[model samples]
Target: MSPTFPARRRGKARVGAALGVSATLLAAFGTAGSAQATSATVRHGVFPTVSGAAQIRANAVGQASSDETLSYGGGIDGIGVMSGQPKVYLVFYGSQWGTQTTDANGNLKFSNDAKGGAPVAQMMFKGIGTGSEAWSGTMTQYCDGPLVSTGATSCPSGAAHVPYPTGGVLAGVWYDNSAKSPRAASGHQLGAEALKAAHHFGNTTPASNRYAYYVILSPHNTNPDHYQNAYCAWHDYNGDTTLTGGAVASDVGDFAFSNQPYNMDSGAGCGVNFLNSGSAGTLDGWTITLGHEYSETITDQNPAGGWTNNIAGSPYQGQENADECAWLKGVTGGVGNVTMGNGTYTEQGSWSNDTDQCALTHSTVS
Candidate 1:
């Protein structure tokens, strides 16, 4: 994601900016008890060694007029819902953005910020990862593959399709407005498109996930500059204030089960270009931003939704940069704060169920 620089003080890395290996936990079976979960699910791992954890004490990331740092400095921390297996959003057949919610105080609520002159509402849908991927549940290491970031479009020849653990259902769909097309209309329009795609799933689920995860793909952002879509502002506080897209690549199609944030303010799929130095086809930035955003949003809808504006301090567990890719190792073994292909600087932070691609001990709130 883009560094909220110029707004940076104290100078630490942005959350999930470094790149490296996944922390391996030793278990009786050689992995955490959650390893090789009994389900037919495939397993994906995350990278964390490339970056170091951040001090994350509110005053670090960005400052305010009153001398306070941004409360929600990006990354998964203090979310309201952090239970069971990790879950995300999937677009619905009849609507978009899923549903919006409120916080503990119930003062801050989710509202629709219009786009293209049309009005709308932003909601939180739930989703999960497919267990039986073509890689046989143990596939990691994605490179510059067209199918990699393309989702169902680039599902290679024999990619398997799996679902989230437990009651995980295809609750909604997400849109994939990559570099262009369906830009301003990303929000609701994207939701509508996803619903259309679900019709193609053809009898996948009758109990749940009966819909497909609709998505759209933009090769290059039509609004690379924040001139048009606020999604371009990514890191700016005002960024979220921009017109919310009614769509995303996730919406162009539908899956048996998909993923999205659990809460309304769930800021998934938006960030500065941090992968391969902002490569066009990398999921690093997408996954990292979406993972952390949804992770925290689902946990604490208000505070978790990046609502507090000053609630910093997300202790990261894994080692990945905002680019959303794995960090294997640098010559030095570990990195603190580093810039990516875009010349933007970011702080390093921990990981959690923020990402469903990997095996996270997904936690939820009461």
Candidate 2:
């Protein structure tokens, strides 16, 4: 995740760094600079993870390509993607996630979730907008309006896109055992527990959190902000002042969040078998790390404003759209098993500026 460097407008600068895979082995994931804000400007978007011999030496030296693809980092308060009807709440954070129940296909069960992973993350967010799911149709072709033009990688005719979650973006779920989560919980206490889950899901306002999102989750063996040494999840909004107990003000406008730890406790370096193996791939890094921070908080919700890879010196500058297909496996839109309507999980594959690449399904743009 952490790459985005340039910023002077919509609070951009996320510098946790280390993800171009090979500048001396990505300098062993080093780089950290963020924590100077007088009026707040630190947006952050990081989901980095690369061990296992740095992912086999970054797949034998052939993975540094980000010439110029994703764009449109123009809207902040006006928001960018998740243009409409995309919700996902799921809080769960604390009391070590014990005692909660409902199974029998009603979903949302707990009892310390040994690895059941909270009903497979509520049936993968109720099987993401059901059967015709083209993997959420590759983010309905990226968008934002007002005539789209701040780095615009594409998206013009009528703009305001990113829809497709027709009936499932799991708009609710909470546990908040309320006082056991912070084993490592920083990032402004996970943005103040996502503004206390937007006042416990009433969704305060800013039009009920403009296409909301707030997965804080974090229990089973805990580690919220350090995310088990670096990141297996990341996404921000409470106006990221380099979070770690900094930003997080929100009077109910800048929402969007994520920090979702508990990726089966980082096994297999955060993707358990990378794609499917014995035991049907134990949660496969919990739905590919929560569907890669839920498609980067519905297309850069409030970090870098929306959509990224501004190309300043391009090494996938501040990546987004599932960080340009993280953890690629088989090929052709990497990582597999997408199925959707209530089963077959293992996801990974996003970033498709009209088929420029990395698009496991795509074909819904509108």
Candidate 3:
């Protein structure tokens, strides 16, 4: 069936509470810092570029304090978070990836991956559920259940909370090389690809996809949704109608996915050397970008359906957990390297409601 684009909710033409870029930054980046919601489908969890993050910091320079806390958006589809064990599927979209090979660490590698990002991504997922990693623990603080009221800032006792990927979140990885990925794939096209991936992984029902998410990784040189020009990456669901192509008709249910472009394509604008310097930091942006999306997906699996800032007239009104702390460094809960079972990776902090701060580390919830 052809995908349908419906006008469910009006999407913003630019990034709002997420990027936190002021008017000056918006003009400088020319919409690069925000996602364009040309249609009615709201684009949620948009990750900004380095310049956008800098603008967020600059906007807060003189402020004595700011409220970045998140409140529930009243569950959408009766779902607030990935309350179950989250399963992440990596889909290498397009034939441009060239030949695929396995690295010594058993991670997938591709000859066309100029920056050696494929394996790094695989390893990052593998390491997430291992080694008592506390990064994922930060998200455990948010929850969705009957006991928790809508717009509640903190999860009440017994509220169904987001579970840590105890074993691991990396469920499967596939290379969809059936066709060349569009040079500039639309939001609908990306959603369609994710649906294709769902079918490929045998997740053909809503229950099977309740906690599943697909990361649509574009080829190295291509710019999926013109991300290279505006933002680094963004996360949304198949149900969002504002997608460039349209909202995908998913018989399996509304699935969450992220448009993970080759971050190396945008250099510092996408996080190349934002954390570290020299060869050691080449893939710094890669992990941070993907991690940012992953954190948002599990928490806000259905966009605003989960935990997000819904406070009226606040600077972070619509931002998600990770959006509250994007690109911050050298402070509490800023960007830094995290040790996982697989290896150490650089990642950004996520918003924690319990502590009412951006937490880089938190005690495991369950």
- Tens-digit lDDT track for model 1 on 90-172? 33222232233444422112233112101111121111233221111111111112222311111233322122333332233
lDDT tens digits, residues 226-331, model 3? Answer: 6765678888888876677767898899899989999798888888888889988899989999999999988888877788765544445456888878888889
RMSD of each: 19.7, 19.9, 4.3
Where in model 2 is the C-alpha error above 4 Å? Answer: 1-73, 78-96, 99-110, 116-148, 154-175, 178-193, 197-214, 218-253, 258-274, 289-291, 303-305, 308-329, 336-347, 352-355, 359-366
Worst 10 residues of 2 by lDDT: 31-40
lDDT order, best first, reads 3, 2, 1
Q: C-alpha displacement of 199 in model 1, angstroms? A: 4.4
Q: Quantify all predictions' global Cα lDDT against the true fold.
A: 0.24, 0.71, 0.79
Best model per lDDT: 3
Give the per-residue lDDT of model 2 (tens digit) for 1-366. Answer: 223322322322333333232232133234212222222222334555645224433443554544437888777767877788788988888888888889788877888888788888878988897988798888888888788887788898988788888767887888888578877787788888889889888888888988888888888787666556444777777876556667788888878888888877877777777678777898887888798888878887877777877655444555577765677777788778988777788888877876677877888887
185: Cα error in model 1, Å: 2.4
Error of 2 at 263 (Å): 13
Global CA lDDT computed for model 2: 0.71
**Backbone clashes per model, in order?**
107, 3, 2
Candidates 2 and 3 compared: the better one by lDDT is: 3
